[model samples]
Target chain A: MIEAIFEKFFQHYNFWAAVVIIFIGIYATIAKNNLFKKLLGLNIFQTGIFLFFISLGDIGSLETLGIGDATPPIIWKPAEERGYLYVNPLPHVLILTGIVVAAATTCVALALLIRIHKEYGTLEEDEIIELEAIRGD
Target chain B: MINTVVEQFPALIVTTGVFSAFTILILGLLSRKICYYIVLIVTAFHFILSIFTLQHVLTKGRIHYWFGGWRPPWGIEYVVDELNAYSLIVILFLGLLGIIFAKRSVEKEIEERKLPTFYTVMQLLISGCCGVVVTGDVFNLFVLAEVASLSTYALIAIAGGKALRASYNYLILGSIAICFYLLGIGFLYAVTGTLNMIDMRIILQNLYENKMVHVGFVLVLVGLGIKAAVFPLHTWQPDAYTYAPSAVTLIMSTVVAKTFVYALIRLIFSVFTVNFLELYINAWNLVPWLMGVAIIVASILAYRQNNIKRMLAYSSIVNVAYIVLGISFFNSQWSLSGALVNILNHAVAKGCAFAAVGAIVYKTGIKDVGALAGLANKMPYTSGALLISMLTLIGIPPSAGFVTKFYLAIGCLEMQNYLMLAIILLGTLLTLAYFLRVIEQLYFREGNSTQKEEVPFSMLAPTMFLAILCLAIGIFWLTGIPLEFLKKSITSMGVIFR
Candidate 1:
């Protein structure tokens, strides 16, 4: 039980870390007052997603079907004809593109935020919404 | 040497188009003014390459260009079949027309500095789209889809804050869709141990009842459905179209999004094959009946919209449902032809309509459909062209819309689908009701009493050219249609099973 607990703690560590980061991003996105902070939250949230993807793809180090055996992921023994499956390369492929997309979206969002600030003289979302209402565009 | 070149010809041509576009983009980044003309030249070269693929595909059985010469069920492949050839021609031609219109509209709407980068992004979008259609590997399809989408998000946001908001919303939803597709692809890849589409299909056919396969199919369909703007997942399209810069909106509405939908058609029909579709039908007549609902509902929704762009957006949804209906009644030659022709019919007619509306918006800054009074007097050629397109949208006689609608009705009838026929007819009337409302104001309204001013020739020329195309196509179809071979091609895709 102790080893299991220790291994669980060590294994999905990055996943949990990402989850925590995602929570912080969500909080910032919702509760923070600044527009740039909200954007920061969005960035943080996307970063968490990227981290989760990368971590998920590397979980082959701990095989679920191993059932507590200290076997490496190789067919070395005659009985061990099939070794454990390696980490999925697919998610890494997915996240690599996701990271690039996240960056592009961030650049465009920041540019729009800059334009919004220039036009309305305020960076707050509520203030901008009010300005839009007044101008009725 | 000849066999090697012949073996790799499809990939070479497809890549040539793709790389040339990328080269133009890079050059444009260094110098924007030069990029504008270069983009046109690059696209023209791509068109020539597409013609070569067309010739080869027509002569040969199918052009299968295995990636790095690695055989299928292992490495990626770029397959150019007759279906791909037809869709390639339509999509690239639309991109050509859209970019042509874009050259002038962009200069007016976008600032002086952003034009070159915008062209680069547009080229990237086309490359991504072409990659999606031609790739014989499923995983590569997803990657290409993202490449297209990433560039699209940037292109859409170039219109400024409202477009920015639209892009942000689009990014969120689009990401979810892509994630779902990747997860589905993961499932498929794990189960079959293959990424090549044809090999996977053969294997999947043997294991049709596998739970993972079912899950994968549903996920991929839903994912692609969102991209294709299927009835339920189409909320992002209108705002994205409306808030976008005129040039951006023109290309996106006319070409980019339509290419995605066409790719969805190939994935669903070609990959899944007819038996899988039959499985949906036997399981509570799912495909056909669901499509019947989509057609009726989407058309009614289109009839009710007030914003011009929103109306067109809803019309796109309604039109997409018609294509899905082809799947429901699978293997009907007429139905498939109707669905296939709708791709061109809608793109050409709507591309021109949006261009005309965009010109009107540039002149008056109006967004509401009711504001189109006496537009004929002010912008004669544009208004006249839009009027004709609206007629096409309404499926009036002697228009391309009529030709396609005729096939769809004939298709539904041949399959003994009366209820579907009734619904399509009803939708056609609803289409007429909305379009005629626009036409009535343009012609008979008293808003023309005042003096009218004309816009620049730059705006008028594109609309007039497309308007001529609309008339020429209708006349050509009347004078015995030249696309009989297209019918044979559709039949070859198991459309004649019934």
Candidate 2:
């Protein structure tokens, strides 16, 4: 019964999850005062897309019904042991790469932030920009 | 086995370039001046690959090698036809020249502590460029482009000062450009169901009428145009080139922008047919015309500059316009030839010029073009190289730039595109006007109180070496191996301009 409800809800919820993640990411990036927050937002936004892709890979997870009270992903354990198969593996691979790239990029961004703080004596983006402006003048 | 080896000459050459770049990146970490050795080793390896590839293509024909032997539509591929092989040689040759020049030039601007990091970024940048040229996958191009861009960003930041801000601006704009590219790729993937360009071409040909695909192409064009620093989207380049470490300028000015522009060409001509863009010709026709205007505006802008580096930045903007304008001619033989040869010519000539200018900056700290009085006496070889590169920049006969312009003019004339020819002529005149001013300043003036140090021996040697290449390409055309191959490759190409 729960599985059926999830199947019905998932087809609709997948897009919302992506949209919400993207919104929160953008909001933090643009609206937040802290540079660190903006970076976090960017990560959230990036991960949101990652989730969307994962959701895409899970498009058919609900179709493998009536496995008679077995555990998930029971592949070839003699007849009755079989339950629902796992989602597609390709998006998982792509998302894995994305995660690695994201991690590297975030590390760089954070390092830049730290340098900006050390040089200008602040972690706020606007303050840093202002300091840089004074230096330019 | 021998036949297969011969058949895959182009692929091997490209991969060899890529592999050499990686090797340099790893091994370049050791020792202080070790980066120089790594660059030399890699460039030598790439140079040999270039010769063999060019010879193979000339003798046999088009060389297409599939990755994992999967054929098109289902598998990725790498192609080195006339266009690919030509640009590959241009990219690699200039890359070699750049590394050689950079040995002394880079060591000057870059502090000892940052030297290893500099070489690592350069290797990544070169490999990224090489990958852009050789890859047949559209998405793969975007990935490689970032590989180039991220390193380019870091390299620019090494210069300090407003270098960070400039790099930041570049990062923002570059991020937007890459995102545009990725978004466009997503759209393309949605439509074609394949990332391999040859496969995409097959699918796109069938769906040429699709509106979304048309939009995808425009997105790609815009994205790449920004990356290539074409005209309107070229704001980041001046700052990046001006503020970055001097050797970085040499590499960026000569190769990075040109690689992306060529990738743009590869997409339109090889991945999408002329018929497709033609259907929307009325809409897209402005692309070439805008390029024409960029040629004019950028040259004029070059002439208006105070800083020498900024002037060359604008001048490079003009050079990119020529390459792009060539693309707009569709399959026109003369235009394409002009565009193609200009690519190689500019690489050699501009590389020499930037190195010479950087050497000047290294010696006496003169960035302003107007007040640099009496520099020649103390730094004769450096100034002499400056003069030759200037002459070459002006497309003077027996110079590298001369041969390139000659071919480009022929391209314009063959198409009856007289306005483009006029633009070319005007651009050359403007180039002469700006560059000759520098020559006059250098050779005429005796000395100023501020002009303190003699040019460094390390810096002057490379400048003189590059200046020799500029003169030798024009004066000693018969014996120059690179030039000889250029002529052969241009002739062997199957595409006819008219």
Candidate 3:
């Protein structure tokens, strides 16, 4: 049972790292009072997800039976005759798109923060809520 | 040549709106006056094209347009089946009315120089919604959803009061929701090795027992649940709707929320087939109970709201729960029809209500219910429209809201869930209680001001049109056009109905 547990651990080590990062990020987002930290937490959480996806696409070199040999995915020669395995490239592409989306979200959030600070003179969520309550009064 | 051109209409509808947004930007720099006309022409064209697309999908089969001639699992594609076409028509039709209503409301609310930019972003937002409904590629759906959401954030912040904070909260929470969506797609890709919705469905059938698939399902559910503002995740909605410009509130409450719900339905039914739910997972069994709780909770919260727009926003949560309730009972024809009918019924009724409120605010600048004492005496037409819409929202007979509740009650009966039936009836009473408070203030209580004229023709036209549609749709619902269409859509997605 211990050997099986170790095997499982070794197989999913990247996922375990991702889980830790996700929890840390979520905790920071929920528990932190600063808006900037919340944004950063979101970024960290996204980064962990990107890492998990990229790792899922990474397959090790397969040298047995003269198939899936380690080689770069270039079109220099016929793909079938090269007798080499190419790690799946789709996840990298998806993550690239994700990075762009993340960047756009951060840009918008930062702009909003700048606006909020200019208006409310505070960066903490609780402080802003208090200020809004005062204004309501 | 004509057939080829007709086949391209699905892609054209989205491109037209986006390209016109850019067109409005450049032309606005040249001359501000022409921008409105250009937006009008573009939205009108978009509406016409959407009607043609829906009619074509109904008459013929689905339209599958490959980007750059690439096939599935490789290149992006736009697929317009009956369901997408119906949603497209609804969205574009609302966009048309929203832009028209914005002419007067925007003039009243915004600075003169910012009008062109307002139209530009509005088009971009509409195009983003259109793209979300049309795209067959899941990644593309995420991209378009962000486009819609980011534009929404900008639009909400445009009002520049409490709007700044509201938009910021929405941005943070919305970003988290989109991130979860991306992660869910990543997990699905890991298990299925494909991103095309149809291809993913085929690949997922084999991976139904995989734990990753389950994780993906849960993540996507939570992610979209947040985006659709389902119950506990709906904290960002009330403030965003209350603080945004009235025209923007109209578009967001109607088109934006509807688009996310449509995407959720697509993900649940199209990407993950019903059989997958029955055989591999039982997570769906919890949906009806959750929605029932949401219906009760959201109504009670809405009942307590003093701000009119915020109250409507909370009530939107109630309508969304009803939709989810219908889809949860996926096996029943009544349940599915109830959900589908509510999409149209709720859209029209809510649009009328918000538009009328916008007009009232435009005329009197009041956003409170008690402050509207004797408003019916001054703005009779607008107030009358509000009354009809509020009754429709409260599910009174001879109104669209009633049809939704009737079908849903029958659905509850079909499922033999008498407890849910009682909850729904209780919800109706609560809806009446809140809306009647506003109605009584409008008609009964005395205002200290003299008589006044109604809102301008521009705003009144769309408000009255939608109010009348609310009544027409409810009274004519038994004619079965929407029912037959919804049944066809549900069946076309390969969901079997008993």
Candidate 4:
């Protein structure tokens, strides 16, 4: 049982790594008080998701099918003739879109943070709330 | 030739929005005043196109346009069935009215230089909403939802001051929500190996017992629940609604929220289907209970708010719960139709209410509910519009809200869910209590000023139009004129009307 568990863990370590990184990012986003830190945490969280998606494309070796190595998703004459296995490229394309969305979200968030800092002269969430309370908004 | 071109309307609608957004931005460099006109023209065009799309859908059946002629499951697709067509019409209709109302309000609230970009983002937001409603690809829905959300955040922040904080908080929560949705999509794709919603639905049938499918189902529900502001995940709504510009508040509270709910419905009915819920998740049994909590809690919260906008925002949550509750009783046809009709009803009622409140804020700068006393004498038309909308929201007879409640009550009877029925009744009373406060203030008490100060004709027209629509739709529903359309849309989702 122990040996079987070890083999499974080694085989799917990418998913386990993604799980750990995702939790860390969530913790930082929730636990951190600094707005900038929170944004950083959000980025980390998204990056973890991206990693999870990318790993899903990687089909490991299948000795029964005589595919020992997985190549990148490229369609060339020699690779096709040689029966080369190609990693799924759809997830990569989806993640590329996701990355652009993430960048846009970060840019908007950063702009809002700048405006918040300019308005309240602070970057801490609690301090900003306090200032808002004192001002009676 | 015309038939072929009409087939391409789905893609044209969204492309017009994205292209117009940039066009406005570039053209505004030379002439800023023209931006509003461009938005008005484009939205008008979109509204007309949506009408054509709906007419074609009703007659010709579902329209599918593959992106660049790549077939489904391999390339992105735009499918406008009865549901999408209905939602598209409602979205663009409200969007056009909101833009018409925006002319005077935007000029007043936004800085002169920001006007061009403001219109640009507004166009993007509309297009994003159109994309969300029409697209058949789940990942495409996520991307377009992000586009809409990002524009919303920018629009709210453009108001400056307290709005910045509201927008920031919304950004954090909204991004997290969309990421969860993306994760859910990833899980489904990992298992099913398909991104097209129809393909995924077929593949998900056999995989319902899989743990990953179950987790993906829950994740998607939670993610959309936040976006739709379903009771527990609604922390960001009140602030965003209260601080956003009047036009933004109107559009967000009505069109934006409704589109998300439509997406949720599409995912539940079309993508996952009823069999999945019946077999594994038993979500039909679960969602109504949560919606019951939302109805009671959100109404009470709405009652306690001092600011009128904030109160309306909470009320918006209550109405959202109503829609969810209506659909959750999946066994009852009355309930499903009630939910679909309520989407149009609530949009008209709430859009009118927010526009009136915005006009009040525009002229008098009064945010407190108590300060509304005696303004009726000065702003008669505005105050009258507010009264009608508040009445409609309280579900009085011969108004839009009444139609929804009557159908919902009949639905409850059909399902024999007495507890939900009582909750609905109690919710109505609570709604009456809060709205009566505003109505009483509008007509009963004396104001400090007596001078007539109605909003511009541009703003008043749309508010009045929506208020009239509230009564007209109620009467329309009573006459059962649109029952065929409603039944067609609901039945097209593979739901049997017993």
Candidate 5:
């Protein structure tokens, strides 16, 4: 059991890091009252997912202790030999789209924050709710 | 040559709208008058394209458009079967009507400088909905969902002041949902090594027992559930709907949520399939119970609301539950068609109701249920349309809501799920309990104003058109106009009970 735990800790450590980052991000988004911190938390959460996707493409040769065998996906030789040694390119392409999406979301989110601060002169969630309620129906 | 053009209609439908969005943006800097006209023409063309594709699908079958000339696994694809065509028709047609309604109403609510920007974002939202419905790639679907969602956050904020808070909460929640969806996609991609929907399905069939696939399924469901505003995840919806500009309210309440539900259904039926559920040890058996709770809880919440749009927002949760309930029983063809029909029925009913309420709010700035006392005397047509829509929501006969509810009841009976049937009956009662409060305020209560104030022709036209549609669909539902297409969509799912 101890050996299995050690194996999981050693082999899947990046995913464990991602899981930790995800927890922190969700906690900040849900538990934090400040709006800017929430947005930053969202970005951190997305970065965790990006890390997971990047790690999925990193299968290595048995000789290099799972770290250093796979080359960048660009082809140097023609047919059979080097093709199998290169890492998968699809996740990289998907991450490019993910980055663009994250950028767009952050821009819109910060813009809304500016507007909210302009209107209420505050950026805290509970305070905004208080203002809206005190203003009343 | 004709076959090729027909096959490419799915791609044209999305690109045209997106192309028109940029054009409107550029032309708005030069001239504002031409922008609305461009919007009308683009939506009309999109509606016509959807009709052509739906007809082509019903007769000639599904159309697949590959990006450039590349083949499936490597290239992104746009697929339009009966399911996609049906949703495309609803979205584009409503977008056309919403644009017409927005012309005058936006003039009342939005500043002149922002008009072009509003319409531009509106076009992008429509294009995003089209892209979400018709895409055959999961990652592509996520990108389009963001496009729709980001534009929506901006549109809601365009109202400014009070709307800014609503849009902020929506942004935070919506971003989290999108992240969950992306993580879900990553899990699926890691297991399957392909992003194409068909390719993923083939790969996932063998990986059904894998823990990653299970995690992927739950993540996707939770992500989309929040987007669809189902029950507990629906806290952002009421504020967003209430504070947005009326036209935004009408469109998002009907189109955006419905499109997310469509994407969820597509993921389940097309990518995951019932075989996945069987292999996953009937883990999805919880879905029906979840829908049952969403129906009961959301209806009760709708009952407690005093604000009209907020109440309607809660009711939208109930409508989403009906579709989920239908889809949960995917092994049964009857329930599946019932779910599909409910999509159209709820869209017409909810869209018309919101439009009429917008008309009333435009004429008199009242949104509370009690403040609408004697509103019927001043805005008879708008109030009447609201009455019809509310009746439809209550599932009264001769209304579109009744037809879908009838099918759902039948579906429940055929499944012999009496508890869910009881829940449905209780939900209809709850809908009646809430809507009657507004109806009484509309008709029975004394007038605050003496003079009659009719809504503008542009606004009244679309509201009445949808109200009349409520009647027509209920009367002709047995006539197989929507029934035939719904059946084709169901058969396309290839559900088998075993």
Candidate 6:
């Protein structure tokens, strides 16, 4: 049973890796005191999801069908004639959009951080919270 | 099939909003004063288009527009079913009122230089909401939801000072929520390989017991629940509401939150269907219980707040819970209708309440609940609007809030869920307790200021209009005018009314 589980784990190592990276990113986001670090963690978290999505698009070897390594989804005459198994381009498109959204979020967060730093003279979350409490804001 | 002009209305409404955002940005460089007019014209146009869209849907049928003439399963589709059309009208109506009200409020609250950008972002926010409502694609929903949320963050941050922190907190949490929603989308995509909601729904009929599908459903629920500010997931809401500019607060609390709830309802009833919920997923069974806690707990929290906006923010949470609870009684037709009606009811009532509070802050710079003492004498129209809205919120007879509670109670009786019925009544009493505090302060208490200082006519008109709408909608529902439309929309969504 242990060997069977290990075999399955090794077969889907990419998903396991993605999950682990996501948890690490979540931990840093939740536990980090520095606001910049939190933003970095958030980016990391988003990157993990992006990785998961990209992995989902990968069409690995299908020996029974005699399919080899998946090719990029570039539709051309020769590739179509050869009948190459192209990877699903939809998830790639989705992740590209997701990446744009992540970048925008980061830009907004960084702008807010700059304003927060200018106002509070610190990037530490606890320090800022304490300051707010002291000022009764 | 671009056969007719009416078919293009859905795309036109959304594009106009996006186009106007840019127009405002470019034109504002020439003259900032034109930005408000641009938003006003665009929102008014949107409201008109929404009305026509609803009329079309009611008379004809669902209007489906495929992007680039691509087929449904492949390309993004814009659909205006009865529900979407109804939600569009509600959102655009509130949005127009919000824009009308923003003229003086924005000038007063925002910096002079930032006026153009403020109007631009507000336009984008409204368009994003329209996109969310109209789109039939789930991924498109995510993108539009992000657009709306990002614009919301910017609008809140524009308030500066303590608002900066509130906007930042909201940004982080909101991003996380969207990411979870995306993750849910990813899971469903992996399983079903389709992103069109209707297509996915058809494919998911056989896969209801799939573990991944279950996870996807739950993840979507969690993500949207946070966005909708449902009980436990509402940590970022109060701060965002309290610190955002008054216009921002009004739009965000009403239009933005209602759109998210509409999205939740769409996903639950349209995509997942009641069969999925009844057969496999029991997670929804917890919704009513959590909302029960939310109604009581949030009302108590609202009662304890010193800041008037903060109090209203907490009250917003309770109202959100009310909508969710009403809908969560999925078996009962009355409850579903009540939930849908409450969206418009709460939006009108809360929009007026916040507008009144904003007017108070605008003229007097008063934020405390206690400081509202004798406001009725100074700004009689604004205070009177606030009183009417507050009474509506407390579910008094012949008001919109009462209609929702009355329907919801009957819904509970239909389901034989007596406990939820009791909770609904208790929630009303609690709502009465908190809103009564403000009403008493508005009318009964003695204060120093007695000058006649009403807000600008532009602002006061919208506030009074919404307040009047609160009672008008209730009377209309009682007369079965709008309720028939709501029931038609609900039935069209495959929900049967007994």
The TM-score of predicted model 3 comes to 0.95
TM per prediction: 0.84, 0.82, 0.95, 0.97, 0.96, 0.97
Clashes of 6: 0
**What TM-score does chain B alone reach in each candidate, compared with the true chain B?**
0.93, 0.89, 0.98, 0.98, 0.98, 0.99
Residue B371 alpha-carbon offset, candidate 5, angstroms? 0.7
lDDT of 3 by residue, A6-50 (tens): 977766687788888887888787788998899899889888888
lDDT of 4 by residue, B1-498 (tens): 135566788889999899999999999999999999999999999889899999999989888889988898999999989999999988999999999999899899999999999999999999999999999999999999999999999999999999999999899989889989999999999899999998998998888899998888888887888888888999999999999999999999888999899999998888787778878876568788888999999999999999999999999999999999998887788899889999999999999999999999999999999999998999999998899999999999999999999999988889898999999989999999898888888889999989999899999999999999999989999998888988899877767754
Candidate 5 C-alpha lDDT tens digits along A1-137: 99988976767788788888988999899989999999999999998998888878765422135444565556465455443567777787889889999999999999889888887899888899899888885
Model 4: how far residue B217 lies from native, Å: 0.9
DockQ of 2: 0.18
Q: Which ten residues in a row have the lowest lDDT in candidate 1 chain B?
A: B1-10
Q: Candidate 2 docking category?
A: incorrect
DockQ result, candidate 1: 0.25
**Which pairs clash (backbone N, Cα, C closer than 3 Å) in model 2?**
B332-B497, B333-B497, B334-B411, B334-B497, B398-B474
Q: Which docking band does candidate 6 fall into?
A: medium
| Native contacts kept, each candidate | 0.24, 0.00, 0.65, 0.86, 1.00, 0.73
Q: Which lDDT tens digits does candidate 2 get at residues B332-441?
A: 65566556766766777788788888888876678888766777776767777878888887888888777767766776777687887888888888888887778777
Candidate with the greatest lDDT versus the true structure: 4
Model 5, residue B452: distance off in Å is 1.8
Candidate 2 regions exceeding 4 Å error are A1-99, A122-137, B1-30, B68-75, B413-418, B449-458, B472-498
Query: Per-residue CA lDDT of candidate 4, range A1-137, in tens?
Result: 99988977777788888888888888888889999898998999999999999987775433223545466656444654544457878999999999999999999999999999999999999999999999996
Model 3 residue A21 lDDT score: 89
Which residue pairs collide, candidate 4? B374-B447
Q: How many pairs of residues collide in each model?
A: 1, 5, 0, 1, 0, 0
For candidate 5, the per-residue lDDT at A26 reads 90
Q: Write the per-residue lDDT of candidate 5 for residues B314-419, one digit (tens) a residue.
A: 9998999999999988767778887888888899999999999899889898989989999888898899999999999999997888877888888888888989
Candidate 4: count of backbone clashes, pairs at least 3 residues apart or interchain: 1
- Provide the TM-score of the second chain in candidate 3: 0.98
